[model samples]
Target chain A: MTGRVIVITSGKGGVGKTTTSANIGTALAKNGASVVLIDTDIGLRNLDLLLGLENRIVYTLVDVVEERCKLKQALVKDKKNPNLCLLAAAQTRDKSAVDADQLKTICEQLQEDFDFVLVDCPAGIEEGFKTAISGASEAIVVTTPEMSAVRDADRIIGLLEAKEEIKSYRLLVNRVRPNLVQTNDMMSVDDVVEILSCDLIGIIPEDTGIITSTNRGEPIVNDENSPAGKAYINVAKRINGEEVPFLDINEPKGFDAFLAKVKTFFGIKG
Target chain B: MELNKRFIVDLSQAKTPADIVFEVSNILENPEAANRKIWLKLGDVSLNQSQILSIKSLISSINSTLSLIESECSQTELAAATLGINTKDVEEELQAELSTLEAESPKDTPSEQYIPLVDYKEEEPKESEHEQQENKEILDENKQQQEEIENKQDEQTTQNTEEQPAVSSDINQEENKKDEEIQNQLDSIFDSEVKLENILADDKDITEMQNWPLTKEAEDDFEIPEEIMTDEDYAILQMNTQYHKQTVRSGQVIQSNGNVVIIGDCHPGCEIHAAGDITVWGVLGGIAHAGCKGNTKAKIRALTLNAIQLRIADSYARRPDHIKNIYVEKSNTFTPEEARFVNGSIVILKVNDR
Candidate 1:
């Protein structure tokens, strides 16, 4: 079966779209499906830095679109996974260098080799945003549960749904802190999902590992030790058609899961 | 197992070209994601042989359905028009070609005289004289109860769109009915160049935005003197200003939870501080201060724009919109309109109830 091209985008910046792309693309690749992470955030490119493959990018997405370099040539292989490739964005040029039509063609070509093409969209609803989602088979709209992010996410989700492929779109809630939500200071996943009104693919909790990992140019999902990383792995598994249980962050250490683990060990049916 | 070649019409296009949309359409048909894989692609160009064929039929069906939908759309459009959309105009358009048919058939006149359309009023303002004409017209025109109810509902829905959105569930049922397919025979007209007409106006700016013919730089930040003038007296004076200082830190967006007032004619150079709601009566020709301090619920309303910069709080939309075409007809910006945050983008609707 051919892979689906998923564009991860958020209307407001710093809402973990690039993070989701790197993590999901890498996670999907780690599961043995060949994945390509196409960073469409031109001028303000960060996916490469997040992926920790910034130095290997001899050519960027603009190069591929402009035909300065072949699609395969511009693809920088991640150090850990040969299955995953990072098609970096052009830092020198702006978003207009690649239009939506060109992106569609690029995705079409990339679709032939890969099982999944995950596009990391630029922040705003500009040319970069349009080009990023041009050929995506579906989209995973990333948003925080915060009011401002949710409002922007609401708009983006509305725009995405107006597209014919609305059914293929799912949401990814990132940088969510369960404690803040519990305290009512932050909007909960339920509130965001309700407003956005889309099927949710993943929920990433606010973790310090994300910050440290970001600084190291490595996405938090690559770290198996982190709780957020496990969640991303589970999401990747779900995307790949595997039946995986969600890790309830609020109740991960609670009695319900504690009892469920006991039940699994005893070979009892759940 | 035999392969089924059922014709799948792509009713999904004519909107956005998003991936989740294509994937979801394919996924809906086969949620199992097993068996033969089908590609649901988007393009004005024919994607494949069957898809090309499918798109043609889809377009025709959509057009035909749109005709039916336009009746509902027109009914809503009429309902929306506060000035009232001329329904008889549409009816006359359909009958224009039928005049030859009527000329051929002499019996058409006598039968038409007996059938009184309950909803149809043979008056200039059909909506105004509803009581006596409606009760008698329904008895004369429609015999079916269900059709009468639906028509009555249509009459109540004199609007382009209904808010409170409770009617979304019922909208589909109304769209199925066949309507008189009459093209707009009347010359479509647009009323533009809003008549400010010596209304009480306040204006001033930091620096005017792009290619505006006039630029005014006023150093004085004028004050809105709290003299409670009568609405009529207030309407007479044309007030204006430059900047109403509110401390906005770097990277901090401006926001207002309520209707915000940008007290001056904003220069293209001025950075506004606003969130929630913003209302600038004067020309907004500069940078919009939005989401200032990270409040995203803000929106800006201005009389005119030839601005250089725009920011929705900390999120800056620099020199945001370039009005490419001001077509007289066939555009949302067909009249003097107001822009509000709708969907993801700003939609220009009639300034007041129209």
Candidate 2:
């Protein structure tokens, strides 16, 4: 069976689009589903590094688009998870090297063997954004609580709605500081949903474990104790169409701490 | 046509394009009117390409329709006029054909009718004594009903558009039936002579057709205003400064070519670019670029200059690492500062230092 091609995009830069793509793809693959993450950023390649497959990348997305290598050859299998793989981007070349039609053909080929194909899009609404989203049927817009990221995400949603290929979309607010949101200093999750007007798939709070994992070139989903890691695992469960209630970001930590330990015992986080 | 159904403009008496436009505008301004279609009886009048286009644009602006009737001119020439082409070049091509047309038509009729030299003298009235009195009474009653129907119809049309905008074709069909019913009732009342008149001032009604010089002067009168491309600067230098009182949120960009003063904070990820000096009375947390037009002399002043980036003309600076430490170590020690270009580099200094 063919997989669903999903594009993860945010119009503004410095938001966690690559981080979200890496975590979500890993979370899906950890559940015994075959998943492939395509890094389409071209000149600014980071998704492979986030998944700790940077040095192992011998064939890139541009190589596949140029017919220099077969699509299967370009895909590098994750060392830890056999069901998860990554197609790295070319750091030397720019986005103009790959057109929208070429990417569409590559995605169609990749979807046949994978259960979930997540395309990590670039930052802006320029050529790179168009090339990354041209093949996807579903979109997940990542936005921070800041006004700049939210406004840019709104602009991206408008562009996605205009495209006939995109059938549906949902929002994921990354890098949320629960303490700041609770004290009224920062924008809350409800405030973001009111403005964006989209189904919120998940909310990943600010955690020091995310930075520690990214620096070490390891996916945070491997750490069961981390709250950010648990959030990603839950997001994967929700994506499977299991009516999973969201993590109570504002609720007292008594139940969440107990449940996170229960999940650790069950070996849900890999 | 029914007398009360359509407005009439007998082009036989109109001498110039300007005179026809003037008459039509007058009739359209009246509140009580029947149909928007103006029946132009071109029995003895001839129009060039420019005159037809000018009349068409005028009627279109008032949301009215024009239907032409030809009696003297050949059907081919009438069709060519209504085709809406700029035929100044082709007018010279048709000069020979028009000369033959002039040879066959009435001798007293002028060959050219577009000259700006017009005579504004009154002509004899067309209404008969008995018909004029009967038309006046019927017109008064018809106008009252017209006003009432127009007000009710305006509200109904707005409601229809708001409720079922997708069914506009159905609304058009219903309106056409209502118009036919109204026309039949008016036709039975004024069955004789209730013609729409000149609808013009007495002076404009009698503009002499013979006063026009029938030469290259017609082209001079038809210099289309739309073709002129000269750019005119109508801006007045009234205010050299702008003040905004509301907070500028993230991703919002505010720019000006003059000095700007803001009473609220500029949040992160937002940008403000100005050509002149910028003064922020509140916290400045975003990117502020002054001297946008390469005016290095411009300065940016803020009560709390906590911006991510600052640029004055060609020089630029980002928030230094030490500044972040200052916020953490001794946040209360921070003071109001203004940034300016000093020797091709942007430097922030305390406001009291200046």
Candidate 3:
């Protein structure tokens, strides 16, 4: 079966593009789908580190593309999930070493063996960004609730819209502080959605578990207790065409809480 | 010709067609100047179509009997004498003046106006004057400084023309080098996989996979027309009120050339634009643009209308600052509301029980 190639990209740096990619890929793999996570950041590679496969990386994407090693030899199988694999980026090579067409060829080959190929894109609207998203049929733009991140996400959306290969893209609002959003200190999900005018695939609340998991080279989606983990699992379900309503992150007050409870009890589905 | 003083009314120095007519009419108005030989110097300036027609009529009225010099060279006595035009009186004065000025200045004579219909540099002198004023202050000491600035500009313009070809060729070389590097990079990366993929695909049952839009090339060949008229399209166009039962999620868009009715709420970032009325059974936190096809009579109705913006035809209304505060305070249960185009603006009113 030809797998769907998806790319996770954020135009701005430090907005959890790599983290979202790892988590979503892991979540998809946990559901018994054979998934390949390709780190396309090249010189600034971090997907391997995030997957805890950094020590196991003997050959990387550069080696596979350059024909120094076979595609199967380069794929590092995950210890956590047997179906999940990591194709690490070469820290020695720059973005230009692998062009878009090359990446497309690699992804096309990967799609034949795996059920899904998720690419972790680099930051900025540069050559690396182009190479990362070249072969993807679907895109998940990760953005924070900050105005700068939202604005950059808009630009990334505009770029994605220009691509002929990318059929559709959904926004993943990451690191959202529900408290700040309610207090109006930060932009709410509604504000972000209004500005970007894109479908909200998932809202991942701010969780310190993500950082701890990243430090241990384990994805946050492994833990079933964390809100961020549940959100990601929900995102994966949504990606797999499940109809799941968004969870209420903020504590609804008084009449609002009663209204919300009624809506939930009835499964209003709006 | 009973000559007193030969008044050369320079048409080239005139700012416009009206200026030329005015200058010539002023000289002609004097009874003494009228009787004298009014030498009309066409100079190097060419008149446009409209200006030529206006000036021709103006000149005809100024002097019925006038001697015309076809070229700027004919304005001189030596050139006029050679052409067999009488210049015996002006000939001696022109020779002495030309010799003395010839040493200090190379002939600053105006060039030939071969294409009189195209030349429109009559306002050039005025433009130059404006440029000079901008370069330096008009203070007593800066008059000479202004002239020097103007002279420097003339030198720079000439230098720019001479160096332009060299600069352009350098840029072209740099661009070509960049293109070659990119070509080399692409050749190195894609040279192997592309050939292997082609061979592998050839080995497969071509006819069995032929129907599928599998390859990127095949997908590209599959074109969807900008406007597709399906059974749904036809039905939507014919219906007065098209009903949609699904909630329009963020990033989703629903458009209709006819009236639309959404049975669910419109979330933020969801947009519903229609040519006619739009009615929502639930809340509308999104944007609803009714009368999108310029039908001003269209209206929008919803159970809860706290949308970010509402548009009817050419007019629109954003959620006001006060409305946001009100929404924050009382957002639990919204009263059913209707929005319409009234007095060139979108007006929303609460719907009472009827």
Model 3 alpha-carbon miss at residue B197, Å: 39
User: Where does candidate 2 clash, by residue pair?
Assistant: none
The digit string of per-residue lDDT tens for model 3 on B48-155 reads 322332333333343322333333332233433432334333334345544555565655632212111122342322322121242232324344433543453344
Q: List the lowest-lDDT window of 10 residues for candidate 1 chain B.
A: B180-189
* lDDT, candidates in the order shown: 0.53, 0.65, 0.66
- Write model 3 residue lDDT over A119-165, tens digit each, in one string: 99999999999999999999999999998999899999999999989
lDDT of 1 by residue, B61-166 (tens): 2221111111222322332132122223333433552465557654443211111113322222222112224334534543464364445334323322111111
Off-target runs (Cα >4 Å) in candidate 2 are: A251-270, B1-354
In order, what are the TM-scores of chain A for the candidates? Answer: 0.90, 0.92, 0.93
Give candidate 1's chain B TM-score: 0.27
What TM-scores do the predictions have? 0.41, 0.41, 0.42
Calculate candidate 3's fnat: 0.00
The weakest ten consecutive residues by lDDT in model 3 chain B span B191-200
Model 1 chain A worst lDDT window (10 residues): A50-59
Candidate 1 positional error at B165, Å = 99
Candidates' DockQ values? 0.01, 0.01, 0.03
